[model samples]
Target: MSPYYVSYKSDGTLVSGPGSITAIGNQTGASSYNNRTSGYLWCPTARDFTVGSGGNKGTTADLATRTASICYMRGLKERVEIQTSSGAPWQWRRICFRFRGNIYGASGQNSQSGNYQTHIETSNGYRRLLLQFTDTSPAGNQVENALTALIFRGLPGTDDWYDYMNAPLDPTRIDVCYDKTSTISSGNTSGKVFRKNFWMPMNKNLVYDDDEAGGTESSTYYSMHGKQGMGDYYVIDFFKAGLGTTSSDVLVFEPQSTLYWHEK
Candidate 1:
C-alpha cells in the first residue's frame, strides 16, 4: 500500500491526516508533512567533538543519529572547545551545513553567527521539520564565547520520492574548510566556501583525498565521507586543544551531482 502523506496549508493549519489524503496532485497547494514529532532521536545529549572523547567527534562514528528534531551544537562556557580534524591548533573554526534551503543565522544579518538554522526542503513533499538550538550559555557574549546550532526540517523515513536513497551519503564528500591563507584570522575571513568542481562520494569509512599528498594545490585537501542510505540528520563535533579558542569558522562544500534526491 502507498504510504500516507500529510501537509499544511499556508495558514498554519493541519490540512491532511493519515486517512484524509492519498497521493498529492498539482492542484493540492499544500506543503508536505511527516507524522513524526520533533525532538532528539539519536544523541540524547550533545556529543563531544574533542579527540579520543569516545563521542561523536569524527566522521567514522555516526553523529547523525543524535540529530534532534532540529540538529544543533551548544557550548556552555567560554572554555568549551570544538575543532575539525584538519584545522590548525588553537584556531577558531566555523560550523557549516550542506543542505539546500533559505539559510538563516542568529549571529547577525550575515551567515556567520554562533547560532544558526537551515530549512532544507526534503526530497519528500513535507516541509515541517525544524532544527533549532533552545539554550545557549553566556547569553550576551556573542563574540568571545557563543553557541552554534544547525537545524534540519524534512521527512523522517526513506520512503519519500527524494529520500536518502538518492541524497549524497558521504560526510567527507561535503568539504568544510577555512578560506583565508593565514591560520589566525577572525570574522567572515573564516566563512564557509564550496568547491563544487572537486566532488567525491561520501559512502566510505576512511578519509578520501582527491589530490596527491602534500601537493601545493587546492585539490590536495582531504575530507571525511558518509554512508549511502543512511539517516537524515548528520552531526559533526568540533574540538580544539588550546586556551581561549572556539573552532566555529569552517566551510562545508558538496559536489553538484545529478542525483535528484534533494527535491521531491
Candidate 2:
C-alpha cells in the first residue's frame, strides 16, 4: 500500500493527504503528535537496556545486555582512562540514558502499527537523534570537561565487529560532543543548571561535524561516525580530568530527554 500522512495545519485544521508525509518531514524541532516531524522523543530507562536480546554480554548482538543499570558498567571504574591535554588522567565517571517511552512495541506515544514508530524501527533513511543534558553539579564549574555520547546501532543477533568498524556512511558507532559552562548554580540548583545538547545522525549519509569553538569533537579530539537501527543504545563518556580534584569532583549527567528524526 502507498504511504499516507495525517496531521493538523498551523491553524489547527485537521488534514490528511498524500502531501502530509512531506509536511511532517519538514518539521524542525521536537517531534510530537501535533508537530508531526518524522521523529520521536525517546526517554529510555535502565530497564529498557536490561531486557533486550543481547543477554548483557557486550558482544556482537549482546552489547545492550552489557549493563545492569542506566550507568555504564554498573561501576565506572571499569571504563578506560585516557590522558587529557593537561597530562591529568580523565575517565567517564557516569554514562547513561533515561526515557519514558519504550523503544519497542506499541508503548507510550507509539502507535500499535503506523508510520510513527515504524519509520525508525524498520526503515533506513536520513535520520537523526539527539540527547539533552544539563550539569547540576554543586559548583557547576566543569568548563574544562567535555560531554561525549556514543550512539551504537545494531539489532539483536545481527551485529558484528565488521559492521561497527568498516561500514561506509552508516558506521555502527557515532560520537557526539557538547560544551559545559563554568558558571555556578545560584539560589536553586535548577536556576543555574548548565544545559548542553548533542545531535547524532541516525543515517549513514548524514554528517555531524564538531564545533570548532574549542568544543569536544574538535580536531584535537575525536571524529563522528555511526547510525542507529531497530536496536539502539547510548553511553556517555566524560573527557578531561580533575572535575573538582577529588573522587567527589565528578560531573553529574542527567539525560533530560532524547529526540530523533527519520527523514525520507
Candidate 3:
C-alpha cells in the first residue's frame, strides 16, 4: 500500500484516507477534509480526490490537508508531469505542496510567532526568494498580508466557516515551471504543462490556528471561526508564530497530509 497520512475528528473518528486519495470528506464542526470522490470541497469548487496521498488540483481549500502521518510524501520530489493521455485532461495545471514535521494543529488564540514565508523580489539586482507575498513584490518579493490572512468559508464565504486568518498549514515556499510541455516522446500539448517543486523539512511542525467566534474551542473545530468572524479579513502576522507555547504546541500524534491535485 502507498504510504500516507491520516487525519481524525476531535471524536477520534476516521477523517482522511491514509491509503487512498478519496474525495475531500466533511466534518460537522472542524476543518477536516471529507474523503469523498465527488462533491463540494471545503473550498467550494468540485473536490478532486485521488488514489495515493496526493491530488492534482491547484486551488486551495480542501486541496491542502494535514495528518499525523504526513510522511506519505517523504523523499518524493519528482515533478508531477502533466499527463498527456490523462483521462482527465482539464485537471492538468501548475501545482505544488510540501510536508511539515514535528508540528501540530494551530489555534486562533495567540497566533503570532514562529512562522516563516518568502517570495522573489524583482527590483533587486539579483532575483532571490524573500518572505511570501513579498517574493512577488517590488516586482518580486512581497508582504502579502492579504494572502497571509484567509477567512475561508465553504464557498469563498458562502457558508459557515472553519477559519479566519487562522494560520492553516501553508507551504513554506512554492516554485512553478509554467507554460511548458511534458517530458515525453509523444508530447501532448492539448493543455498547458506546468510543474511545481516543493521543499519540506522534518523538523519544524508549522502549527496553524483558528479562533472560533462561537467560543466552541473543540479540537475538531480547530482554527475555524464558527461563522462570527465572517467577511473580516485578518492581517495574518505574516512570517509569524510557532513558538511551541501552550497554544502553539504541535499535536502529539503525527500530523497527516496528502499531496493533493486537481484531476478534472
The candidate maximizing lDDT is: 2
Off by over 4 Å in 2: 1-193, 204-233, 239-244, 247-250, 261-264
Candidate 1 or 3, higher TM-score?
3
TM-score of 1: 0.18
Cα lDDT, model 2, residue 43: 18
Under the 3 Å rule for N, CA and C atoms, how many clashes does model 1 have?
27
- Whole-model lDDT per candidate: 0.22, 0.23, 0.21
Best-to-worst lDDT order: 2, 1, 3
- After best superposition, candidate 1 residue 231: deviation in angstroms? 1.6
All candidates: TM-score: 0.18, 0.21, 0.20
**TM-score of model 2 vs. true structure:** 0.21
lDDT of 1 at 33: 26
